[model samples]
Target: MKILIAEYAGFCFGVKRAIETAYYEIEKNSGRKIYMLGEIIHNPQVISDLSKKGVNIIEEEELDKLTEGDKLIIRSHGVSKKLYDFLAKKGIEVIDVTCPFVKKVQDIVYEHYHKGYSIIIVGDRNHPEVRGVNGWCDDTAYVVNSIEEAHKLPKLEKACAVAQTTLIGRYWEDILEVIKLKVKDLVFFNTICDATQKRQGSAEQLSKKVDVMFVIGGKHSSNTQKLKKICEKNCKNTFHIEDAKELTLEMVKDREIIGITAGASTPDYVIEEVIKKIRFLKGEKEEE
Candidate 1:
């Protein structure tokens, strides 16, 4: 069996920066308590490594428990404006590691919202990044993830649209086109991250050439799920796995070629392990 790994797999610039920043802050203030609002990134392995290093992951409800001098790291997914304000009001030292691409979407929403333009975000509403962007617009922005949702929106006199940084490019275009038809005066910004586009594009192309495809990343990761969906469209045998341990021999037994792609937050070691497991499985079958 042949294994084809994607050219654009593993950590992206933003995720890399966030992880590095977390480590730097942890080391810089060894005695102070450090907490992250959520997982610094979506990968379990990375989060586990950080937790072993004394970093604590706290939920939103735990915010009030924090006191002055406590350091809170804003995750790469960013947070709502209200959350930021609340953290400041509580006097917790905030180390913002929000991805620049996500920050750009927030800034754009804030600017257009204040200028009397209705904000429309083309992505999953429940996603942390989308929720953060919505917060900047006072939770008034319309979050649409599909062409169906876009069509349901009421006609607007003025509006500005921005996509979640990890949204698939084709899905964004499809939703945007529907929004354009509904809004009289629309300003659209393609806020999808460049890395995301390349990753999705590469996954799609690779899936077409392989008999089975494995998309590796955290199950909760939006981008990783998007990659799985993209690959599924081209290769029906696509499987989404968080790690190599989830792989079964039945998934690989008859496939002549396998393609592997990972999300931005996936670590190199996880990808390597998955590849190794597949090779071992193939070798054992050959010996049989």
Candidate 2:
């Protein structure tokens, strides 16, 4: 048996910057209390690791529970203008970690919305990042995750488009192509993260060359889910898991070559553990 890992796996630059910023503040503040606006990233393990370090996470429902002077840290997904203003009015010290790539999407959505172009967001509607993007344009933009959903959309003023930062680049392009043909004066921007494009492209190539595909990352990680989607499209025997416990001999049973890829939020350590598990499984099969 063999294991092949994608060349581009694990944390991208944005996630790394956010995690570093939060960890640095945690160590520097010592006794001070800090609260994240949301899950720092969608990775459950990373959030658990930070929680043990005394970082408190708060969502919209928890806003009223905040006390004066408690520090507020924005997550990398970015937030709506209303949320930012609301936090500002609370007089809390804000530590913003919104990814620059995501921030650009927010601006694009807000600007086009105010300009009166009906907006179309091409990504998962329920995703916090997409929700945040929509929050800026509320009544003007419609969120559609796929062509099927887009088909139900009503014709609006000339449409302007933006995508969730983690959207697969090709998918975004295809959706944009559809919108262009649907709207008379359509305008679109490719706000998908370059890192996501590179990662998916690499994963697709790796998947075609391997027998079993192991996609590693947290279940809630959007980018990680996308990685699994890409891998499974090329390799039917793809498995998505966060840690080594989920991997077993049965999953790798008849495969001589295995490919491994991880979501953007996944750490290098997680991928290493998966690799180690595959090697152990291979050894067990050889012994049998």
Candidate 3:
């Protein structure tokens, strides 16, 4: 059996920075209660490790119960302007670890919305990143995730658009084309993360050459799910698993070639474990 692992799999720059920031805060504020507004990143293994180290994940509804002296770490997905303001008003110390790429999109929406241009976000409506961007525009932005949604958008005189950092490039272009026809004036920024583009591109290419493909990441991770979807279109035997424990012999039996890729939030160790398991199942010696 031959195995091909993606050259760009696992943590990207932003996720690495965010995870490091969380650890730094934990070390610097010893004995203080540290709470993350949500999962520092999308990976379950990473979150579990952090929890064991005393980092707690707090939900939106739990915000009101927090008081002064509690440290809040903002997830990489960023938060809405309202959430930021509310946190400030509550007197909680906030450590913003929002990814720089996501911050750029928030700034763009804020600047253009104030200038009288309608804001259009090309991505999932419910995604935290898109919700954060919409918050800057006072929740007035139109969230379009499909060609059908873009076509249904009312004609506008002037509009400015940005994409969720993890959006697929082709889908973004498809939606943008329809919006261009409907709007008299349109300004669109392709905010999809560069790493995401490269990872998805590599996954698509590898899927075409492999008998089976594995996309490893958190089940709730948007980018991971996108990778799985892209791979499935090319390779019928695509599987999305969170870790090596989910691997089964039946899935790999008789497969001549296999490909593996992971989401931005996945850690190197988790990817290594999955690769090691695959090698073991195939009766191949592990790499040094």
lDDT of each: 0.93, 0.86, 0.93
Regarding TM-score, does 1 or 3 come out ahead? Answer: 3
User: Could you say which candidate leads in TM-score?
Assistant: 3
Candidate that scores best on lDDT: 1
Clashes of each: 0, 0, 0
C-alpha RMSD between model 3 and the true structure: 1.6
By TM-score rank, best first, the candidates go 3, 1, 2
Model 3 segments more than 4 A misplaced: 285-288
| Residue pairs in candidate 2 whose N, alpha carbon or C atoms collide under 3 angstroms | none
Per-prediction TM-score: 0.96, 0.94, 0.97
Q: Relative to the unseen true structure, what is the C-alpha lDDT of residue 86 in candidate 3, on a scale of 0 to 100? A: 92
Q: Each model's RMSD to truth, in Å?
A: 2.0, 2.3, 1.6
Question: The CA-based lDDT of model 1 is what?
Answer: 0.93
Cα lDDT tens digits, model 3, 222-275, are 999999999999999999999999998888999989999999999989988888
Model 3 residue 96 CA deviation in Å: 0.8
